[model samples]
Structures are given as structure tokens and as C-alpha cells.
Target: MLNIKYDIVGSFLRPSQIKTARAQYANGEISLAELRAVEDEAISDLVEKEAAHGLKFVTDGEFRRRWWHLDWLKEFDGFTTEHLDIERGGVINHIELGYITGKIFYDPDRSHPEIEAYDFLHKEAGKYPGITAKKCISGPNMILVDNYLQLGIKEVPYYGSDVEGLIEDIAIAYQNAIKDLYAHGCRYLQIDDTSWTYMIDEKFLQKVASLGYKKEEVLDWFQRVSTKALEGRPEDMVIATHFCKGNFKGNPLFSGFYDTVAPIISRIPYDGFFVEYDDERSGSFEPWAVLKGSDATFVAGLISTKNPELESLEDLKRRYAEAKAVVGDNIALSPQCGFASVEEGNCIDEETQWKKIDLLVSCKDFI
Candidate 1:
């Protein structure tokens, strides 16, 4: 079980400096090195603030990239982003999609930008004692779910109709990536995934059927890919998964409960699970009863990052009690999701964001 009782879902709201620097880089007003200097300063300050706030871990705030998942996904071989001419209405229409042009593989000899980012975070975090620099990456299932299941990019000559083969290759690529990260001194890794929640969404279920795939089969594939990715993971490395309904611009893309995915959640080989429960859309805590006696830590995301209004202390304790009744003593607390899953961020202001973080830290006293 993870010794820490309070945690964060990783990404913090991007500061104005980063936003301006990125835009300058895009418009050719600033060089890439100049933009990186701004990001470096921002991240260094972020690590100091996180440590001062009493957080056990710190991230680079994902400041280097635009979209959380796409930035990391595009780094892998055979995966590239493309603009689609066809417009699918709803949340899918807002974002860029990825395409698999060849077999997915991770060449260890090549330099990875994420590794370089992690190296900087690890160094800054080392300045403060007892602080671990945690790295957050998109889960393996994200690529398949977003590209194939949602966007219907089903035709890939390499895997051609062999869905299981595709999943295996993705798993292998992720396994190699995890090994590489461990080598880079990343002991705490969080897989930020929105796909698990999609499995329970009604609209997403309809889309699954429309794609000629059964809901159960897709769940199994998600589980398989996730499990295979962690094969032979180091014992000292702590791997956790954060599951939230899409978090884009203070809005959720899908709505559902954890009831349907509880069994699959129990089956995944993660050391912990950070589940969204900040509002009515998450449903009841009864589903977590499936994990009552397990050693894995169940992080109840009882605070809301989307809303600025602070959660009442009494109400937070009450809800924590409700979760404790079902999931036993192994539990932690965090905001439902990151302050910014994308570069746009949630609706809350930075002052309010830190206040929420203060509340998160305070809640740990009772736990």
C-alpha cells in the first residue's frame, strides 16, 4: 500500500508565461530554446510551491506540451497526428486525432523528449528533501480508444483486423517505455486515463456498437493492454492510474458511474486508483466494495478541480467516511482531476486552485 494519504492528479493550470511563450513559438516570434527557458523557470517554481504546500510528489505541470495525451502519444514511433477533414460533432470535433502509420515500437537508443523533461523535474525536486518527482503519461488504452473506438480510424495495414495483435504491440511499446522511465529514476508513475470512464458511458457504449465492437470485448482489450504494459515492472516503482471522465475546459466529455467498470478496475495490476467522485455523475461508492480487502490504495477524488467553490470540510469528511466503509483503510484523497488536462485548463483561477490544494492537504489530517 502507498504510505501517502493525500495526493494530486498531476497537471496544474498552465501559467500565463507558458501560454504566451507557446504562442510566440507558434508565430515564429520566439525560438524553441527561448520558449523552453520560460517553461524551465515555470516548472522550477512549481516544484518549489508543491513542496512548500506539503505535497509528497511534484510534476513538471505538463507545461511542455499542448494536449496531455497527444503530446506523449506522438512521441512514440509509428504514431503521428493528422488533421481530419470529416467533422464529427460533440467533444470529438474539438481535438486533433492520431494515426498509426507503421508498427509501434520504442527504440531505446533514440532520445525521448519526455525523458529529458523528467530529468529536469528530478533535478529540481532533488533540491527539496523527501519530495519525489512523479511522471504522468497517457495510458496504453488511450491510443486505441481515442483513435479507433471514438474516431473510427480502424483501418491499419500492419495490424489489419487483428485487434489483439495491435493491443499486444501497444503493450510492448509501453512496457519498453516504462522500463526506460524507471532507468531515468522515475519511481512514481501515474497513468492518466479517461478511457476507463468511457467504458461506462452510455453514449460511448452506443459508439462502440456502431464500430462493430461489443462493450465487453472493448473492456477486455482495455484490461489486457493495461495489464500487459506493466509486465516485469520494478517492485520499487509505484504505478497508479487516475480515471476521470474527459476533463476539457472545465467540462466532462462523458457522464457515467463506476458501477460497470469496478470489476475491470479490480483486475488491472495497478498499485492504486485515483477515481473521480466530486459530483453526482460518479455515482455511488458501493462499486468500490469490490476492492474492500485488496492491498491496492483507493484514492477518493472527493474535491472538484472544475469548480472554484471550496468543498465543505464536514461534507468531505462525510463522503470520506462513506468511501472508507467500502474500501477499507487503504485510501487517499485528491481533486477529481487535474486543474488542466489540456492546455486550456479548468474554469477555476490559480488562487482558487491553490486554496483547493490547501483543502486537500488539510483533509489528510483526519485520514
Candidate 2:
């Protein structure tokens, strides 16, 4: 029974101070304590700013981490990351996580490392009575692809040829993590995923085939794992999933609509969806026909986060009009994605980023 009309995808452009502090910490010039102190102050200021802008939920701006997903990935026990410098857009190259190595599992009684950040965020958000603090984590399916399936690596010496069983362990881990998070007072959680978006793109679909994964089977796998992850959560806990098509230096790795994957996405048990609809690259609202009548809400990402250029309000209204025509009142609005999926951020200043958020908030008046 949670509702929010205007929201964000749970990240903001990292401030210069945070970028500098992280670099200093990496170079051994600063202590972990020093870096965390800087993060605390930046997050405190960020929550206040988000509240002032009329945001119903606030994040730490994801300022304390490097890549949003990798930070959380490392928190789990059985995963190790290798750095692989990958070419993105040919002009901008950055580190991409190589295939993760290890078996994934979780003891249900164990505490999540991320709980500390939520503790801090919950306290900070309490300062603003009506605003909820949101925690965004990488979903189970994304973890499977990022760690094993995409790289064609099998879980060796342990559960080899048992991919389905491995998926069960991942979902159980996700459930344990969610339960722990709710215990720590988190009411809003977003599972950031890119795997579902990959399925809709033709090129990535070919890649999936090349990797020995059938598109239909993988889609069903993603749905089952995602649903299992949300099991046994508190009735009041609000969980949503953000479907992202690779966001690096403001360039999308794939371009396509949700036509092929709509049926599966529509059935995810999460309370809501934060879907990308920024431009034609995301295709038309034809998928809404399938998404209609679901109990879940839809946060149409009509606003763009890839660049600083403001979207024409007229264009957004026109698109929303089409979407609403299909889904009716189950729809809400947000940016297509986070301002920065990683620490480097989109090619926009913090001011431009805030303005993008302001645009989302103000557009609610006319919509």
C-alpha cells in the first residue's frame, strides 16, 4: 500500500569532493574512516537537497561507492571481481567487471554489509517526516549474468550443470538480504537490473544464443529468480525493479523496445516498475497494452538522464498521454535512469543533474 507519484531511479551525479575523496582513498593517501566521513556529510547534504526538491524518496546519491552494482556485489561472501578495461562508445573506455569467480550463497542469519548505509540513510531521511529513504541493490538475475552466464563460466567443482539450482540459491540470498534490510527499517527498495533490457535488444539476444542460453528460457529464469527474491517480505515493504540498458558515459549499449519481453516483465512480483522510455531508442508504448491490469505500478521514465539537455515538457506529456491511454492511472513518472550508474557520472554538472530532477517534479503539476 505504498504510493509515490514522482520518484528517482536511486542515483545522482557524484560531487567533485566525493570523486576526489574516493581517488585519495584508493591511492592510500586517505583512511577508510576519512572517506566514510566525507561520504556521510555528502549524503546528508544530498538527502536534504532531494527533500527540498519534493522528492518522495532519497538515496545517498550513491556517493560512497564506485560502480553501483559492484559495490554491493563485493559485499557478499562468495564473489571476487577482476578488472577488465572495456571499450565503451570507442571514445570513452572504463573498467568493466570480468566474470566473477566463486560459488554464491548466503546464511539467512547473516547481516548484510550494506545495512550500515541504510542505517545512516534511514536516520537522515527521518529528518524529513514524509520522505522515505530508498536502498537500490543489483537484482539476482543481473548478478547471475554479471558473474557467470554472460561470461560463459560455469560454477566449477560445485553445482556444475545445475544452473537452476544455483538460481535458487541466488534468490534465497536476495530474500535473506531483503528481510535483513526490512529489519533495519528500510521500507523502500529498488532492484536495479539490466538483464531484462538485454533480452529485448536483437544484438544481445544473439549474444545470449551464442552463450548457449535460449532467450525464452533465460527470460523465464529471470522471472522465477526475481519473484523468488521478493518472497516472505513484510506487507508494508515496497520493492521495485529498474530495467536499464547499459548506461556508460551517457551511451546505451543496446536500443530496442520491451515488445519481446513485456509479458515476462509484467508478471514480476515487485510492487512497481521503473521502466526506461526516454526516447525512440526505447521504442513506443506498445508494451503498455500487455502491462495494463497488473496490480503493480509503473513509473514511466519519460525524462532522460543520459545528458544535461532538458527534455521538452510538451514531448513528455505527449508520450505520457500515449502510455496513460494504455495503462491508465497505474503510471507515474521519473528519469529514464540514474544520473550516474558509476562514480564517473553522466557528462553533466551537479547543477544540471538537479535541474533534471526539478523538471521531473514540476512536470507532475501539468501531467
Winner by TM-score: 1
RMSD of 1: 1.8
Local distance difference test scores for all models? 0.89, 0.81
lDDT of 2 by residue, 27-114 (tens): 9999989999999999999999999998988998888777878777676656656776665556546565634345666554665557
Q: Identify the runs in model 1 with alpha carbons over 4 angstroms from their true place.
A: 84-94
Q: What are the TM-scores, per candidate, against the unseen true structure?
A: 0.96, 0.95
Which residue pairs show collisions in model 1?
none
Error of 2 at 216 (Å): 1.1
- On lDDT, the leading prediction is 1
Q: What is the lDDT of candidate 2?
A: 0.81
TM-score of candidate 2 against the unseen true structure: 0.95
| lDDT for position 254 in model 1 | 89
Residue-by-residue lDDT tens digits, candidate 1, 1-367: 6777999998899999999999999999999899999999999999999999889888998989788898888768888887655444444545677877778888768999888999999999999989999999999888888668867888886887778888989999999999999999999999988888888888888989998989888888998999999998999999999989888778888888888888887888888999999999888999988888888999999999998899999999999999999899999888899999888899999999999999999987798
